[model samples]
Target: MSDRWQEMAVFVRVAESGSLSRAAREMELSQPSISRIINSLETRLGITLLLRTTRSVSLTDAGTVYLDRARNLLAEMEEAEQAARGVDSLHGVIRLAMPVVYGTRAVIPALATFMGRNPDLRVEIIITDARQNLIVDGVDVAIRLGVGQLDDSTFGARKLAVVERMVVAAPEYLLKHGTPTTPGELASHDCIIQQGAFGRESWRFVRNKTVTSVRVSARLWTNSGAGVTAAALAGLGIALATPLMAEDELRSGRLVRLLEPYQLPPAEVWAVFPAGPKPSAKVRAIVDHLAMSLGEKT
Candidate 1:
């Protein structure tokens, strides 16, 4: 009989990493050996699971369906082993994904506490503002922030908190240019716009059931949240930032919030996981911990 479990493990790792060489390195196996196992699996199954190119690898349609099922099977197997051992403590590595700024400022603190509680568990956090391919990346959980409900139904989502954006400027900038009281006045101000992932050249404000969108000009643009906050603090220009991003500066009176009468659309913070399988104990533990902790502040 074929070593079906071994082949499945190899295939899953290869799919998640998106590169055979990378998967081989992670699994501590030779590239040719990994390739052979995948080939044998495909030949035995009589279906091509992956579409390989010189530069990248992707799943075939059948491979996508198989992936979900495979995950379910693996999760069940792990649960069986854990149950047999009569131990429920969280262990092993949990891969997490989240945006850079919020993850650093918010999630990391909560994660530090969680790690302290679960001594056997290790976490690998991937910080990016861009939405990562969770299944392909092998992320155990993802924390996402967005203005509208996330359209993806493939992942099981838990809404953790809602965060509002803040329009802020350095105290010196507000003093030099004067603060904008109306949405229309923002056009005349030099606004710093974030440029990548969650980039927006325009901002929306609402008051008394009326919503207004103001397209502002930018002399400075950045992809990093820290960069936008830094530029604002240096008196470069006004910046649009999440409350968490501007919290310290706002508390110190280095930055001032403008147009307080209007409201910005609140972004929902979500903890998401792959849909096929029941969440592992580790996933549930961290999710609950974050929801309880971050919910209070946001």
Candidate 2:
């Protein structure tokens, strides 16, 4: 009601800079104006936000709590402003977090084309199997693969595509060890397993609407999806991999899909963002680009 957002922005900058003079310099506002804003904010909120001295300013306990919330509010405010303006010509660095496998195989290539189209936009991709918090990690958008519904509803999700897992091995490995026809028989075969989010090497398969999880001995177990793909390519053993991760290998007949009749638990690819007001235009643009490109492929 009282231009609270502006006050919050000024407050956050002051907290970060640790002095009114520094914050004023950074925000291009007079030091007196910055002091007046802080005074007005503290009076309105009925709380002492800063302990000011001749040379420094520090947040009180109340200020510490408010600062955290203020930062998020300011970010959402800027995003709302940008979205309202439109997404026709996007220009900014978007910090995107996604799984290592998909990020490398799909997102990286799509980004190449996206950057070519929008010469002004830059993307920073954080590739990891671990899930990252959008606000805490400062990630604008994140691509996640999950079975059916995502567990956390605090983040908004745009369904991109369905990810199908294939039990695959190199032709040389299959030729030497003989491909198993049933999911149960996987117990006897040497299976190269990539550790999934569940922190286990159990591979889940579905047939006739019934799901079964097979805990196979890993000829080699690794957290890296690329490592798993490489192992399978080198005739190490059977690995459960997403089609996109091994798209080229699958297409070129370097890796062969095994146990086709038995289905693996399918994952839905989602573009996720921190829950707030409508997403920023830059975020939407990248998410839309992924949906278009990945949708066609999947």
Candidate 3:
């Protein structure tokens, strides 16, 4: 069982680093030793984990599944060690990455209250639309929107909320250009799009029990959701945006929903962390608080 844990750790390192040599260097072990441990693990588990070639190695499907469980086990073991040391103090920095609009409008607003409650804990938030590599960036947590594609063995994700996208235009713009009664009419209008991680172009909708898709060409493109919303507010064009980002404008009547009849698929907001045995008290607390607070509003 002790050897099993060591082998599991080796496998996890390899999976994360994408190369046995890199994992060996990180673990301060020889490459041959790492390979031997992994082979021993495969023999014991009766499952082939890595498909290795001279050039590179990748996880087989079984490897991917086992990796997630192994991570959870390691995390739990770390937590147990911390608890035994009486290190219950939540005084570590938690680095988080999230989209700008969500960070500003949703997360930032909620953070003030969260921070006030946990004085020992500090948070560093990076706001960008780009999907950052959490391991490479040394990020503790990530707030992402959409169906999470992060492998279960490598990362753990909890759905925070379902974010519905809406077609919105400033009241003045809608009055001038006329509202798009249907999805097809959007082609005739000047569309402002957010062109980054959200993939706004490949828009999907459901009508009459049939799923339909449309590829939109935008005259103005910005990676910032705020920028796109601002363009829409200025009566420049129609914008597709999440309800949370457009909540203020939508409520103030600055931006009005167009094409109300068609329903678009909602993107899920998630709080994700690296999958390991047991998460620390601080990480668990933050995730729980964020899930509870942000879930209701979004």
Candidate 4:
């Protein structure tokens, strides 16, 4: 800061010591040099810092406020320095954003374990489905789904997991309309659209190296994965979703996975960050933990 930090350090020492001679001795500088730094700092700030007398020095009101704030800033800077120097490096707040259902069901639990290992670290979590501007939001990192979503993203990413998805329908709906044996048969059935989860109108399946897309009628449309599971549970229509989104229902037999012979392409999850400076040690460490933890569990 053009030596402003040095000036503040000198001012803090002089204010605490209450004498130019003592401050100079503590810093190994001449008393006249210490006096000049304090004078320049007060002049540049346009505020009187110390009430100087022949034998004693005391703070003015403005000086008292500045001292409190300066101490806090200096302490934070020291902590940042320690982390950068790799002395207990995971020592700062990391703002992370992710899709709601996936984050709650998958990421947050794993994040809790990561936090346990690095107790000095703090995290602020943002749950959302919208694509966010990392710089604007001050997001240090983000967890995102789908390869297509990341194609135009300015952030860089590393793959975390490939989530398998399948078509599902409530037992009541399947009972009403006979179950389809092939992907082509979905053309006649109404499907619930998790608006952005899999994309619009068309659903694709891959079988024995052959890929096929089928356009189905949308019976309901929602922007959330949880909503898709809700509608499917209500016997509304068939839906495309990962097992995590409807884990309870799937396990309880309320929803049944369909199209056993074919498979929907897996959704790719990534740890994405802004396009500048390499990710810090804490960020990289958490990503590594997530890759291993989330991969094995979900």
- The best candidate by TM-score is 1
What is the TM-score of candidate 4? 0.70
Against the reference, the lDDT scores of all candidates come to 0.83, 0.80, 0.78, 0.80
In the predicted model 4, the residue pairs found to clash are none
lDDT of 2: 0.80
lDDT of 2 by residue, 156-236 (tens): 789898778888999999889888888877887887766555234577888899888877877788777788889999999
Span of 10 residues, lowest total lDDT, candidate 3: 146-155
Compare the candidates by lDDT and give the number of the best one: 1
TM, every model: 0.87, 0.70, 0.67, 0.70
Off by over 4 Å in 2: 1-87, 112-120, 198-200, 208-213, 251-253
State the RMSD for candidate 1.
Answer: 2.6
lDDT of 3 by residue, 1-298 (tens): 8998899889987886678887776677999999999999999989899999886678899998997888778777767766785754455567778888887888778777778876777787889987777654556678887633544445777777777788889989888988777787777888887765465666677878877777766788887778888899998888888887798888988889877778887778788777443555667777888888888875
What's the distance in Å from true for residue 44, model 4? 12
Q: Which residue pairs show backbone clashes in model 2?
A: none
**Selected candidate, larger lDDT, 1 vs 3:** 1
Give the lDDT of residue 24 in candidate 2.
85
Where is model 1 more than 4 Å wrong at Cα?
Answer: 151-153, 196-198, 275-281
